[model samples]
Structure formats: C-alpha cells, structure tokens
Target: MNNRLKSVISAAAIAVGLCFAPVQAADLPHVVILATGGTIAGTGATSTTTVGYTAAKLGVDKMIESVPELQKVAEVRGEQVAQIASESMTNEVWLKLAKRINQLLAQKDVDGIVVTHGTDTIEETAYFLDLVVKSKKPVVVVGSMRPSTAISADGPINLYNAVILAGSKEAVGKGVLVALNDQINAAREVTKSNTSTADTFRTPELGFLGYMQDNKAHFYRMSTRKNTADTEFDVSKLSSLPRVDIVYGYANMDRVAMDADIGAGAQGIVQAGVGDGSVAAQMMPAFRDARQKGVIVVRSSRVGNGIVARNGEANDDKEDFVVSDTLNAQKARILLMLALTKTHDTQAIQRMFYTY
Candidate 1:
C-alpha cells in the first residue's frame, strides 16, 4: 500500500479502539482502601461486644463487601496491612502503614486513600499518618463505634462516607483527616471523645473540617497545622523511635512510676497533668531529673480541651519542658514520639509542638 493509504488505515483503527475502550464511571473517583484492623473489622455476638469479640475478622474484602455502595463512589481496591486492635498499634506499625499510604498516593491512578482503623487509637494513627505521609491526594482514616455483629452497627455507613470523602476533590491537600459519624475532622485536632456513642470522635478546638451529606462531602474549614509530610523530615528516614511513655498526675501520685518508665529507657515522656497542666509537687523533682538526664519531657493537659500553660508554673518552666497547646494528653504523646525521631533538641521539639 502507499504510505498515505497506510496512515489512513492506522488512524481508523485507533479511533475504533478509543470508541470501544472502557471509560471510568461519570461520578466515580479512583480510591485505594488500606485496611488496618480496628473495631470496624471486629466481630461479636452481642450488643455489648466492644471487648468480647474477635478482631481483624472482616479484612479488606469483607469490609468492602459490607459497603457495596463504595464501589459506586470510587474505583475501590483494598490492601490489608495489619489486623490488630488499635490499642495494640505501635510505632513500627505506624511506620509500615505510612509507607503503604505513600506508595498508594504515588500512583497516578489513585486519587485518594482511606484507612479503616479501630477507634481506640484511631486518633493516634490518623495523626501519625498526617505527620508522615506526604501525599497531595486525600488520606482519610475511619472506624466504627460498634462492631459489625452488633445491633445498629455503624461500620457500613462510616465506610461508605469514608470512600466518598476520600474520592472528593475538596479533600485533596487537606492533610490527613478522620471521617466518622458523618463528621470530617482534621487529624491533628481530632480525638476519641466517647467510648460507646456513635459520635465518638471530635475536634474540640477547631471543630470539624467538614461533613458528609447526600453522598457528598462538604468542607467549611481548612487545616492549618504543619505536618511531617510538609516538613523536612522524610518518612523513609524513620526506622524505629525511642521509647515514649505517658505519665498521669493525680493527688498522692507515686513518683515510682515516672522513675520506672525513665529507668526502663524511655526516651520521651508525656505528663498528663491536672488542670492547667500542673504536675504534682512530689512528681516535679522526678520530671526535672528525667529532663536533666536527656529525656524529652512534654506537658499536656488531661482536661481534654485547654492548652497546657508554659511559663506560669515555676517548676514546670524551670524543667524546660515542652507544653502541648490545646492537644490532649494522648495526642501530645504521639507528637512527642514522632518529633523525637527527627530531633531531640528541646527548642526544635517545642517548635513542632506549637506548629503541628
């Protein structure tokens, strides 16, 4: 055939192939679901089965099966990274999960990612992912208040909303978020507020970032917190973190526990202090000693809603401790642990506390 005739035939063939090729659904977005076992994956025989049943039973496939509508919202794929209770989650587990999220977000075809986690420590994991996973695509962490076997099980709806939030364009570049009870919360500010209520997770200070309605997610506020993903610290550079412990303060508190944790080689300590983040008079010396010995000390209020004071208390100020502004005790612990991985300098760590 002549060269011009051959070109005409090739163009016709290409046009025919384009017409036959599959097109993505009109409203659907490409979403990757990373399932790490939590209450959402737990199974129980009774209504009060919060602590009575097997965990990690649902896995990713079964979770997607329970929420078939997710398929309509996004081209969903599942990968089970772990199947442990949220309480059993550790720094190593977080590192593995962050790495997986990084890999998924790197894919051009993946528009977003959703994580199924247990409510017990979901906030911690969510915050950890927010800090470390460097992705412009949305990263949503979700869990249910009740297990699948319980009456009025909330996992299906929560999962459905999670997929919708993950697939939404508004979610992009919003840092990591936790979608639960129809509320979209910033990872840095959200925390588990109740044990049994469906509305368990909340962002006390800044309120929710947004919410899900009519199969779509709506946003009213944006997160301003700086994160590891947006910082100089790289996730790949983190391997293992130094030991960190949460020390609670109460009347007649024993100093032995603080000493014990420090003696046990804890590299970081978070003090869940009384109102205004006050450490007990007796525990002050032990905290100072720990700080002097090179352990990073962070003061966080157990009050749940207010900032821990930094300069008013003489002893606390003298210890050169970092104060968590408005972050609850547990969240402060997670931040301290992550910050320690990057630097042990108290000043730099303090800046992290203020910023993230």
Candidate 2:
C-alpha cells in the first residue's frame, strides 16, 4: 500500500469510529455535584461510632468516585464549595452556594444540580435554593446521618439517588428537593425532625413529594406553593441578605432575646411563639416596639406542623404583624428575609407568606 492510499483508509476508519462512539456528551445530561462539608463526607474513628466523628474529611472528587453507580444514570461533575460542618454555615456561604448554583444552571449544557450538605441545616439551604434558583432544572440537596466511614454509610446511596433525580426531566419545576432515606421532600415543607437519623428529614404538615422505590424516584405530588422559577428572589446580585433572627418562645420566656435581636439591627424577626402563635403578655410590648422600629415581626408556631392562622386572638390584626403560613420559625425567617428584600409593608409580607 502506498503512503497516500494508507492515509485514505485511515481517514475512513476514523470516521467509522466517531459514528460508533460509546457515549456522546450531548446525549447525556450534565449533572454537577456542589459538595459542602457534612456528615456525608465525615470520618469516624470507628465504624460503630456515628457521632463525635470528624466531618468534611473527604473532598468532592472522592465523594463522586466512591459512588460508581452515579455514572450509570448521569455524567457527574463535582466542585467542593465548602468543607465545614453545617453548624458553621453562614450567610456568606449561603450566598456563595446560591450564586454558584445560578451560574451553573444558567449554562445551556447543564441540566441539573445536586448539593451535598450537612443534615443539620440542609433544609435551610434547600429552601434558600428553592426560592433563589431561577431555573426549572432539578436541584436536589442530599445529606447523610452516618459518616462515610460508618458500617452502612448512607451517603453513597443517597448521592446516587440524588444524581438520578437531578438528571431526570420529571424532577424539573418541583422546587429544591431533599433526597435521603429514599424519600423526596420539597424544601418548604421538609424539616430536620430527628437529630441523628437517616429518616430525620420530614414534612409534618405536607407529606413528602414522593419516595425512592426500586432505586428510582417515584413522585406522587408536586408542590403548589410558589417556588423555583415562580419565585421573584434572585441571589445573583445579593451581596448580603438582610438580617433576620428567631426568638424561641417558652413558658417563662421574656423579651430578652427579642430585645437583643432588635438591638442588634434585625430587620425582621420571626417569633417562634407558643401554641396557636400567641405572644406572651410580657413579650407583646417589646414586639410592638420592634414593629415601631420598622422591624418586620412575623408570627410562627414553635410547635411543629400546622399553619399559624391569619388573624383572630393573636392581636395580629391590631398589632399589624405577619403570620407564617405553614412555615416554621427557621423557614419563616428565610421567607421574611426574602420578603423584606422586595417590600417592607406588613400586608405585602403577609401576602408573601400566603402565596409563597
């Protein structure tokens, strides 16, 4: 065979190989894993010791590599956003995470996002993302009760399922989802019920969006609340979120916490009031003064589940306070912060509680 003839045959072979390529990037949905330090990456001194372990021992690359099954569902990429326990989570980190998510989801090539976070504050981060992420692409936040070194570390399976959910077209517009223990929960409803358990994340009032069965997500209901693409929140230009604090109510609770929070320049305060969202007689004066200082006072029940009813008996009508509709204290704080960004009117804030 002459040199020219040999080259011609090689070109034909190359064309044939290109046509038979195993997997094309365009054919696969691109899924990015934004890993923040949590129990999912934690290291235990012994397999039996679940608590008192070192968290964030593993990085995003190792986490993705450990879950080989993830590749079977979608092409996974990872970026370690933070390596600290969620207890150390700050407003700075929240902004960074939301900004990164918005950046990625804006890309035409990216299909979905999966965030690995600590179970302690995963619900907060999920709710923030649900409100701020402007895309219809799926965003799944996942965490584990056990560290990576545990006997039956729940991180791998949770992560695999999260990737599966993120890459699915059906998951779009369902808002940010918390996937763990084979369950799918909307960010607005889910909460950390148990301190140390795989099934800790639960939505007491509004049950889970669906469950993970047969290693696949089976969604039963979609959230009706405004979220994701429906929400007006955009964190792309947010340098810092307005300060909001929660005041837990108790039997003998005084207004010390509320006073201190207002003194510290809290733009909004969520009163984790006692049953039925009633403020103690002693705390009323301080709350009134807070509302006088232009601080948005929102009423939410400390008790889990159930919506804090609007008007009636709580003096909400007279005091002009906002009521959190089905949102707990922490979640109410999240909503109030976003609401303050848009408006300061109590009526407007109340409508936000109702609609969002």
Clashes (backbone N, CA, C under 3 Å), per candidate, total 0, 0
Model 2 bad stretches (over 4 Å): 1-26
Candidate 1 per-residue lDDT, tens place, 284-305, comes to 7888899889999988878888
lDDT of each: 0.85, 0.90
Q: Top lDDT: which candidate number?
A: 2
Error of 2 at 168 (Å): 0.2
Q: TM-score for model 2? A: 0.92
Q: In model 1, which regions exceed 4 Å deviation?
A: 1-23, 46-51, 315-317
Scored by TM-score, the top model is 2
